[model samples]
Target: MDIEQIRKRAQEIWEAEGRPEGQHERHWQQAEQELSGGGELPQTSSPAHHSATTIPEGRGKKKSDAVPSLGGEPGGFQPGELASKKK
Candidate 1:
């Protein structure tokens, strides 16, 4: 029927398909197809908001070695020491 109706249908299909990984393209294309009504949806050159490869795998590639420490350990913050300064 209308664009909203078609998009709703396509979204339902996308959700039904196990919400599979790397399915953003499929979702966008299907949404356009369902909403286009035989006329092509105007294409935009703007980059897609969500990129598939950006999803990190595993616990995060092992961090490639420990992260550079910000400062000293957590206990370095002496409790109430900063609060004393305000008074």
Candidate 2:
């Protein structure tokens, strides 16, 4: 039901079909299709979703330990709140 599960399942299917290298896009698409019961998964926003860091700014760099700069942003937002709000 999660992205990893979907990805693993997709990889298995892709390999079963014929483990052709460089077909990552096809594997992901097929995986999303199967996971969504033929409906489209929300199109991937970017490669950030699959990378180690959630932020796209630092793709291969180590995350800094410095204090985060919220820059006058409002507080009281809990984890998953923003995503839940969208639903």
Candidate whose TM-score is highest:
2
Q: Which is the leading candidate under lDDT?
A: 2
Give me the displacement of residue 27 in model 1, in angstroms. 1.2
Candidate 1 lDDT over residue span 24-82, tens digit each: 57666766675666575433322333354365657565533444433356434333355
The CA lDDT of each predicted structure is 0.54, 0.62
Stretches of candidate 1 off by over 4 Å are 1-10, 38-87
Model 2 RMSD in Å is 14.9
| lDDT at 60, model 2 | 46
Residues 1-87, model 2: lDDT tens digits: 689988897678666655656767867877778787886554333343346545577554864445444434665334335634544
Quote model 1's TM-score.
0.31
lDDT score of residue 52 within candidate 1: 41
Worst-scoring 10-residue span by lDDT in model 1: 41-50
Model 2: how far residue 52 lies from native, Å: 38
